[model samples]
Target: MAHRCARLCGVTALGGSMTRCVLATLLLLALPVPAWPQSAPARPVAEDPEITAALALVEARLETERIRRKIPGLSAAVVYDQQILWSKGFGFADVERRIPATPRTIYRVASITKLFTATMLMQLRDAGKVGLEDPVTRYVPELQLRSRFADSPPITLLQLATHTSGLSREAPMDYWRTLRFPAVEAMVAALTQDGERIFPPYREWKYSNVGYAILGLALSRAAGQPYFDYVEQNILRPLGMHDSGFQPTAGLATGYALPEGDAPPKPVFQPDYGGYGPATSLYTHVEDIAKFISLQFRDGPVGGNQILRGSSLREMHAAHWIQPDWQSGWGIGFRITRIGSYTAIGHGGGIQGFRTDVSLIPALKLGVAVFTNTNSDPDELTAMVLELLGPVVERAQQRSRPAPPPAPAEWRHYLGVYRTDFGSRVRIRLHEHRLEMVPAEEPAATPVVLTAIAPHQFRMQGGWASGEVLRFEVDSQGQVTGVWIGAYPARKEALPE
Candidate 1:
């Protein structure tokens, strides 16, 4: 257009065709170019104002709770989506010396060690050296324990994995207070001589430290290395959990116990399970345990090391045995529970002086580990942390993205008050292009915003209402009917004419 104008005005004759062409090129360069389509701004990093703020409050409340519980010291680490969001400690790890505990502070992990022992066995299983169905006697024949059943079904590796083996809970003595762990040879000798069963083999779920002891012996024999050595080399070292092991080391957190009747916290020796070390002797801090937890969430090799087969890892997290009236069930080594709608699988340990717990949420890729020098229930602390983390993480994961897809515009006819038969009233309202279900009776309750996961099927994206699917029921006349929240149906309140 510029060239045509210049030619009509006789600029080509005034200068030359070459000059006119040059002028047109310069004019085009000087004109402002419109940025018609610019790239979108960077999405906020998931961990920002909200996640960090909630975490700060979480830390403060937990510290206060620690003092209230009279816990000598506690170290905690929270992992979200494969990264440790934060790790902190409260109170004195060593009361007499006033040494502060830290997330790196090593404490006896106790029964949580069973998971690692189970990991070694799973490794052997992956290597094709052993089978889960193989009998315990096949490897550890020294355990000449008998069964009461007529066709005595031998206690298999599966039984030991699920804690259903009819082995005694402890060794013949009260070794907990004594801290005198017998050698593997001595434990085996006493197996046939004095060992007894609390229940018959494969009868029921009975947690047995001695059962794991024999299982460890079998694992060690199958791996052709000592139990501790095999676990350290294969599971711990490969996963970069160098600070984790089965022995008490220098600078390790001093174990403390409250002398009966409100006495001040006193130091206690870290218990050695002797031959049963795999069941209860492992010592590690929160950070290392978090790493180990991360590995459990990862089904494949991480950082160039493959510890267990992916199929085996899924098996480890599976709820194989469920107990009556229990909130959770037993997996291969992990104790599986529900943290709201999320499935958390891990283990907890309570030794003489220390209490520890580790929980991993595979769906959210989050893990929490708590270690206490005092014998408070670490699982409770971990559960508290998970409850605090659940909503905050859900918000973080859903941050600053495009809004949830809108429900059909005409569906507003169904948006009204919904009442369950149990008298729980919910107000269903469309907000920000999604369905929000708010418990109308509770002023303090957070509304659960739901998203469609399938055709006409919505899952609660946040709050306590999570995992509840709202499938709208349409009548033959195309009028909206009640929606099923669970077993109960929430009938929609009629709109005013």
Candidate 2:
């Protein structure tokens, strides 16, 4: 029968129905049918319906503001977790050529450059080659600026990173007005002769571009490499920010001075920061900036390079010096700002005709970057984005957050009331797959979480007993009898039917 069906299938391929013949042959021989290969399902995008709706609202607001402010061109992006949720541009990169601005349109990012310098310094600090408490003079002994207060402590690297170094705000030259920045050696020499410490070290937070310039020079000396080289090799390249550079480069958007009244916008000539590049000389686009923003959201590598440690990034985000207003402060290289219930850490930049702002909301793992060709407060755009998109992403995260893993089957043996030797009673309950110790008297209070570290040992989270080891005592029958919380014994109560 198989031979006859095989011959029938071959004959049908020449004229008759081949599908029917093949089916008959397979049935006769009872051969398994081969399956066609299936293509993989499409990956889910980061933007969901809620996020899309919020993005529409954000786009409307951005367009309205871009026109109202008379910005020639601008770019903006929103990052959630480790992904860029949305990015776009408005107006024209070159109004004369009618070139439309896009997320790839490059612009001078100004003071945002300080963040790169800060990250490099933090990397060196974490590598144990330099100490945060080390004096600035240790690296730059050629620095001869004088302090008015004799009792003031010598300036430290921490003070420099936090903007409390008491250094002058500029490089002791008319660089901003002249647009002719000095070289590193000449700038340091001029500063030594003309500059004076504005305030005692750590006395107050005084923003000093020259302080960061000095820091970069000192960092170079400590790392035994050029400052820009260190940052480029360790940070920009590792983060794959190839479009970013400290000099004028291709794809740069023409910057325009803020137009006066109805007069046409005047294009401003771009200038290089020279020795002060570390503080305000970065030229980049929204796409590369998005990569940097994603770095702030997680600790792992990007394209196989670990830019900075997660703990160090957290330290950089923490407030090192707070302003008198209580709403603003300075982190290592970031600006700490408070908006209602949210705490944002990032930086703002403005030089000549360009303006930019970046804000990272650590709690939500969300960030926003706004870049404009013409001078304007990009921070306003950032605030609106956070207000509009932040809540939606946060709620979505809460909804999508995976449920806790199922409790172990053996966990039931440890659940019950425990009477401590000190006459205190605590109840161990399995709530939401977590082992929590609830006070018997105040069950309404927040319970302390217990995390399993071994077969019968757990660690307590929070309270005065944080980090203390907890061991469950088991009987020969494998039933839990009591628990030992750092040598303090607690007897378990009998289970009721």
Alpha-carbon lDDT, every model: 0.76, 0.81
Model 1 clash pairs are none
lDDT of 1 by residue, 126-242 (tens): 788899999988998777764555655677887887898777776676555677888766776776777755576656788888778888888899989988888988888987888
What TM-score does each of the candidates earn? 0.72, 0.80
**Model 2, residue 165: C-alpha shift (Å):** 1.0
In candidate 2, clashing pairs total 0
Which candidate wins on TM-score? 2
Candidate 2 ranges beyond 4 A from true positions: 1-48, 127-129, 300-303, 324-326, 405-427, 437-453, 456-497
Q: In model 2, what lDDT does residue 219 have?
A: 91
